[model samples]
Target: MAQDSARQAPAAPAAPARALLASFLPALAVGIGSSVLYLLMSGLAERLQEVLWGPLPDALGIGPYSAVWILVMLTATGVLVGLVVWKAPGHAGPDPATLGLTAVPLPVGTLPGLAIAAMLMLAGGPSLGPENPIIGVNVALAFWLGHRLAPRAPGPLWPLLAEAGTIGALFGTPVAAALVVSEALAGRPMRGALWDNLFAPLTAGAAGAMTTSLIAHPTFDLGLPPLGHPGWADLLAAVVIACAGALLGLTAVYAFPHVHRAFSRLGHPMLALPLGGLVLGGLGVLGGHLTLFKGLSEVKELAHDPGGWTAGQFAGMAVVKLAALLVAASCGFRGGRIFPSVFIGAALGLAAHALVPGVPETLGIAAGVLGMLLAITRQGWVSLFTAAVLVASPTIIALLCVASLPAWLLVTGRPQMQLKEDGTAIR
Candidate 1:
């Protein structure tokens, strides 16, 4: 009788356990693939420097390769962009503004564009970062896997969840990446089962963490200052710093798209990239060696050892980096703004610190990263997470909440690009 009643009643069937696994499987593949890709790309970027620039140490009577890296990177990037523009289906490639850390199912074809572009840009010395490529490659791989394993995923937006999870896992911060995914999906009403949502993030995050560990043992040290008890002054300063970051971000948002558009409109991809290379070369000549490539060394030096550079040098490098970022991104170079922006912010913050002695280095660095992220991607959670993680200190945790205020305020509006349910873009 109980069985008959249970059968008769209109009960919702329990979801298949396999469905959950299938939904998250692509993310696992992407996480694994991306970890390998990151390792290779990181090595390639480093080796390209050692091989190409290594000889210059003795011949030039100077330190390292000097500013020639920009030329090298620009030429490589030009070739890569030319190939992508001519051969690739999506001429433009992965759009970070549209995807965030969320897994949006993109064609496998887009992956090559993103991968090559990132590698070249990094190798070529563009003021860009690897995170975007990491995201792009993984997201594409996941989508491809999803299509093969569970054909229904693209339709259900599982790709986006997987991406968020993978990113969270990659960064060793599931909650933070989840927050970014949620921010991207902010306006949308929840459609899937609660379990599906929960499991997807968990799997993706776990895969990312495992993959990262497998590739590169995680040993993150930011040389953070002790998080002292915050007095009213510190709180007040945080507010001021956050607001300053907002201003800086606003400037970047307004400038970046216009730069990209202007460069895209210039002649053929081949010619444009080379010309862009020339422009980058000229800028490098003017900006000093530190401004040539991705701002990693500069960021490391500035953050940990301020005395390594003079105030004039810091100010000059900041301008050069900012300009290099704009030019490289605008001129059809492939890479993400996240790293360059963070480095720029760090430099800017350090410069500010020199002027104002009271501001802690960690706090200033955090504020700069958040500010730049807000300006470039309009990703609130990303901006907040990046800033907090840069310090990697528990005391800075409270300030993360505080610093997020400006970013939250700035990025509160509806996204400029929206997508339809069928994976067709909606403006």
Candidate 2:
């Protein structure tokens, strides 16, 4: 009887392993598919930008970097995006300010408008990321494909796989998706262990990350001096910088709804978007090209030679970038806020380092990123990972962890950067 029971247990475990492997195959395919779609969309935008900023400027006999060209391109981008939102199929879904990183899947038909708007925003230099719209497209397509191809597949699996895949592709890593999804799923009632639920998503994330790496090789490393050891002064400086960053982000958060409401009051895309673009252009003139786009490359440019910039210049860039983010988010631009917030954090960090001259550059940058990300996203784990990953410094990890406590306290119970329909803030 004991021998028979042992044999039966082994057989039962084999069944689960088989099931897991079966689920994993589909998840992997979904992840790869999602990554491919994301790459295609991003590639299309890059091609559009090359034409708009490269050959078109030459054809027009105007300098591509001139103020006039910048203004014309941005305004035209706004008009094109506005017309799409007003007249395209599905009306480009919902306002991004009211949506989070992940929402219910949009209809497949809505993907075309969203894709066009997102592409225009990317090429036209909006202070936004492709995270939201890309995820929407991935999710809708994944869900539709799953239903059509595998009717017996689990219903909830498609959305989870799509989200994980897109996040992995976006950040160029599976770990980011794991950390984000884990934080999001914490405390929810579940029938199984977290890792059990996570198994399929993780598979998808890995596939997505690998696919993106093979194609784009996206990275956030700043190539700063390595932080060797943590000192008392480093901790203190981190705290101060983090606190300051939190305050800066809070200012934006407080102003978010007002800006959103103001633009929304224009009552139509035709009036609102071009005006927003004009305002953005004027701000661009003030900020120069450094404050444009989603800010990933721009932040690197700012940090490449920190000694070249004055404290005042860093402050000005930070302020301008913040203003641009507010305008883009409020004015119906189709993109995400996280990348812009990350840029703002990097600018604030560099500004702090410039002003004080005592804080190490890497430490200041890491702390500033941590605090600003926490304030903006309210995701502590994601903030920590982003800050630490950018600098790739272990010595400052302890400092960043300590700084996050007070920064969290400041941002906690305050209005978040997101907007809700009820005119109240998300806390």
Candidate 3:
């Protein structure tokens, strides 16, 4: 709330302190409201997926994950998404290639088209997550409505609250929202009382988390056996797996612009997206349905039955998922890379453990996720947080914190997966 209340520049006496109390109601509303929309989006997509992949496949007498069916569905999804991009207002919202985790709100006009495109992407099975567009949608809605509802609040206030709320809903926890938002605000010069400047956003995050928990009960725990204690070898496993995952992610990061340009050369979303869908279908066929969709559920599936897959199968899954993420993002899909990356990391981690029995499986997973998120998102706190959450072990938490250090170094100066309009890395 004190975004502009630096002691050096502020003229209002006790105003910054007063802002905290004044902001609580609006923050709570934004949090709860954003969580509602988040859940609605997820529910709509889940229902569509059940119909498309479940009933319709059975009714049509085709295996949903069969190679032929996978290709058709993905390719068809691409075309449907292409039509949305070509015909929908705001071109189905901005090209995801040129965006980050959060941005200033888009026009309310763009929301419907963006929502449709994102839902199609989710239900239609391109290896991506709801996070990016969901945040965009929530932020846009909050900014648009908050102005009319709270005319006296700062212009930046609404989006921040919504962003925090959406993130909290996504993770079903205020911890993630706090870490991520605080990380973003860390270096910016701001005047504030000792109380968290992120009070309003944090409040919104708590509300959102509580709302999501009440409704969905989502969790990150992958059901991996606990890493009860750390040892020297376990630490080494964490370091090696994390660094390996980072390198693997960087390969995709470096290749991102090339893949985007390759699609860009096709000259239009209508032309490029279908072909991208075709590629994703092939990947899905190779990786199986377990590697499809946002990786959260897939990772859980993989974790539950680690022994069901061989080392080679796990390795193939990881590579295919990474390739699918690259193609999906490059080809104009509206989603985030984070969830898919999680799938890749889980696959890779399991592969590592399969190849070398000495590495503790939980430690391997935490480190692998730590590395992948580091290279992909480049958000240190969020990376560490996500990796630790997956295993839900206090011991792995400490191990991942140590694992993140060298892993961070590997990705620090490298190109991020995000790009500019010209298809170059944003850095």
Give the lDDT of residue 369 in candidate 1: 71
Would you list the rank order by lDDT, best first?
3, 2, 1
The CA lDDT at 415 in model 1 is: 32
Q: 384, model 1: CA deviation in Å?
A: 1.6
**If scored against the real structure, what TM-score would every candidate get?**
0.82, 0.94, 0.96
- Candidate 2 scores a C-alpha RMSD against the true structure in Å of 3.3
For candidate 2, the 10 contiguous residues with the lowest summed lDDT are 10-19
RMSD to true structure for each model, in Å: 4.7, 3.3, 3.6
Off by over 4 Å in 1: 1-27, 55-63, 68-76, 87-110, 152-158, 169-172, 192-196, 218-220, 310-312, 410-427
lDDT of 2 by residue, 206-257 (tens): 9999999998888888999988778888889999989988999889889999
Question: How does residue 133 of candidate 2 score in lDDT?
Answer: 90
Model 3 spans with C-alpha error above 4 angstroms = 1-17
Which residue runs of candidate 2 sit more than 4 Å off their true CA positions? 1-16
Q: For model 2, name the residue pairs that clash.
A: none
Pairs in clash, predicted candidate 1: 73-124, 103-159, 103-160
Q: What would the C-alpha RMSD of candidate 3 be, to one decimal place?
A: 3.6
Q: lDDT scores for all predictions?
A: 0.64, 0.86, 0.89
Q: Candidate 3 on 1-427: residue-level lDDT in tens? A: 4665575573755566576879999899999998999899989999999999989989999988888889999999999999999998888788898777777799998899999999999999999999999999999989999999878878988888998999999999998999888887876776664245789889999999999999999888887788876888888889999999999999999999999999999999899999999999988998888877887888888888887888899999999999999999999999998899988888899999889988777877888888999999989998889888999888787778888889988999889999977778975
